[model samples]
Target chain A: MLNIVQRFMKRLVRQFFKKKKKVKIGLYGPPNGGKTTLANRICEDWLGEEMGSVSAIEHETREIKIKEEISVKSGKKELKFNLVDTPGIATKIDYEDFVKKGMSEKKAKQRAKEATKGVIDAIKWLDEMDVVIVVLDGTKDPYSQVNITIVGNLAARDIPVLIVCNKMDLKKAKKKKIEAAFPQYDVVPISAKTGKNIDKFYEALFVIAG
Target chain B: MSLTLQFVPYGEIENLDSTAKVNKLIKIVKEEKIILLEGRIEKNEETLLIKKTMEEIGPKFKGIELFVMYPKDEESDPIQRLKKSVVDMLLGNRQGLTIIGPATIVKEIRKDPDKIQLLTKNLSKRKKTPASRSKSTKKKTKTKKRK
Candidate 1:
């Protein structure tokens, strides 16, 4: 009788865990490199609503922002992804915007200091990620601060890093340059603004994200 | 077998002391096959991080988001809702997901950036965050305490 109860409990627990399903993705890139644009593109298909802010200002994102519960469906399989967008990565930070909000210059400076933490935060995500979308700017070459660090770091973690070369609509986009630099990984040249190569991007994500 | 994990830095982290947020995150992240948290967070944000780290790695990898946050605003208080704004920019229906700071802020983000450096080192070196460190490894020291 005890064995029967144990078996029943085991079955119950198994069912509970097996029924659960989902996926999470972290968006990363340099300042003004269009990280949020990619995230918005992903979620737009899910909720048909634009998520996150896109702007020309550098370091627009200060802290780590996570969007919980994004439902992504690939045919019969479904995934719940929590999209987290990042702040820009530069060598220095400006506290003026923060200070304008009534914070003391000292606190503003301190807050400005904290804003720079995004770079390290970007690295830490590798251990915690299953799939890394290294959003790239097609208008520019692939070798730069954020690109080098992002690709190099993702490769080190052995995490599947998908190179999304964004802004392909621009005439200056040179996909070959980035593809040549990181030939080891899969590079998908795309335009986040127009949703070009989005389908291909998702197909790749579905396989690697698994 | 080693659980392969991947990560990407995207957004920022804030809202200390919100267990509900963490719990909700845990629920969502626990569903993945593996979980990884990348990038740098402030000293004050560590506790909140552990809370979510527990969430993202609940069961463990194969299907998880490489969530990353780039910080922009940095006020000590919730005055401008920088956290919210950051989220808004990253995932909450905004135009661009970026942080606005000066040159000092850029170079400064990399200083003594052990956590940040740990991440970069782990990625570039292909080692674990603490495992890579021969140093007694920084304990789960509280990030920056609320001023």
Candidate 2:
């Protein structure tokens, strides 16, 4: 009789919490894929502030940053959610790579250590995401193992995904390649740095988050 | 400078659970051997393997390059596809090939409808040029020729 009562109470509490929770939108991709830049763009546009720092170096965002209660207006419709900017996921992180990029050996090792933890945290947080925006560097090949793994995880969880092909400002940015790589998801080509075609991304969010 | 390719039959890992199967593959990959697995693991297991790989990243062990190729159902007729599905249900879905290798060696794995390509990096040549000496050498040669 006690166990049955406990189960009933647990179900009621879960239902109440689920109704009160905000939709969590996650920014995920490989390192240096402009995830932070996009996060900053969204925060700046909606919340009137930046979310995190952006850098040219890989693994710069070594922690998960969340901006809550962002309300976006599209015409007469409005959507509200919490934005999550996760660390760039990578299968490999060698301190030697950082050393070659002009960091001291000690700092390189420290960055590498933090980066591995960041990847693990990003994967663990996947279960909490309501919608995920997969940011890919448009100048690079989209047919990579890291990209595959991220997409595969999202598919397994049945989460809605929007692929953002960032860096469309660059001459080498190939949006077509990204489209071909992930034909299932809606691909939005935008330059988060230059703020090009970002409006289209905002409009697409309504359909995806619906 | 030597490369090793270890072929793992489905029977070898048929009894192991997802974690053990991933661990076995990682152990072989950490030794710098390329694994050609007879069957592809589950999608969730692939994600688990990636999570484990991220945890194991360190100085000597960089990570892994993985790719799986399976036969497409679109090529078959509806009846043939149904038959294939029934067979798969009974015998397990072992109609795919999975390739996993250390990232230090295997650079990329490209796949098409009909074939797959595995690209490798030359570590010895890379070690010889601590920095990207090859690019600097090319620039020097170009300047000399111009002079």
Candidate 3:
């Protein structure tokens, strides 16, 4: 009788874990590089909702936000994963930078503290990521210290990466520049704000994370 | 493995004038070498670089690539990470290179991160004879294009 109950409990636990199993896909990058915007775009496409709010201000997302069971289907192919949107990673964060953007001193300092903590939390969570998408500004130069560090850590961990070169609708957006910068990784150029070439972004995700 | 060159700015990179730094970057990239930078460039400087590289140099040069490093906190231990996670029930903290090379010979940059693939074929490096070139260029418009 006890053995029957133990076997039943074991099967129940196994089913629970199997139901909860989902691949983790993380969106990571610098502040205002549109990590949240892209996250919102993906969630809206699959889940019919947004993951989090976005702002022009830096470090607007000071905590890790997650949306689960986002299953993307392309024809017969289906990819299901948990989407994690992390705070922008910066080597330095200063309250004065926020102050210059017209934020009050007290709020700016508070934001800085939270943002700094957020950065650490993002790094800690890297170990749990099954795949990572490093979203970047296509108009900006790809060769920067922050970009290197993020890619390097991913490389060290052997995690798959899909580089999203966002903001391609702008005249200054140069997807080719980003391609040249990180020739090793696959890069998908898209305008998250305008939803340009988003289909290609989805296609690349199937190839990369699927 | 392919040949690569790397550059790291030591302390006080900010003291240098932004324009001069961009000019220096342009000169380095034009040399057709794969180079890695130590840190992120300023936003205005990054914009200036893309504008200048595209407009002045034209299609021959491939665009710049960026890689950002992950930040490290005070603790390196796994136990400490878990402990902090528990403490984070109390407190919190957070978040997140340059790769430059010429396009023609350097084909793809790989996961090795620093390694670039170079073309084994020497077709682009070959010199052309005028008569042979003229014979190949049957179109008159094509003949005058390069000159």
lDDT of 2: 0.87
TM-score of each: 0.49, 0.85, 0.56
Interface C-alpha RMSD per candidate, 1 decimal: 14.7, 1.5, 13.7
- DockQ metric for all predictions: 0.03, 0.52, 0.04
- For model 2, how does the per-residue alpha-carbon lDDT over A39-152 read when each residue is reduced to its tens digit? 999999998999999888899999999999999999899999999999998877788889999999999999999998898899899988878999999999898867877897
Which candidate number has the best TM-score?
Answer: 2
TM-score, cand. 2: 0.85
Best by DockQ: 2
- The fnat scores of all predictions, in order, read 0.02, 0.78, 0.07
Where model 1 places Cα greater than 4 Å from the true spot, the runs are: A1-22, A94-114, B1-147
Residue B135, candidate 3: C-alpha displacement in angstroms: 82
Worst 10 residues of 2 chain B by lDDT: B123-132
| Candidate 2 deviant stretches above 4 angstroms | A1-18, B76-84, B87-92, B112-115, B125-147
Q: What is model 3's native contact fraction? A: 0.07
lDDT of 3 at A110: 83
Q: On residues B1-147, what C-alpha lDDT tens digit does candidate 3 reach at each position?
A: 235565745233445677777667767766655555555455445544544543333324433443333233457799998886676444221122455555433443444444433332254663344765786667766768867
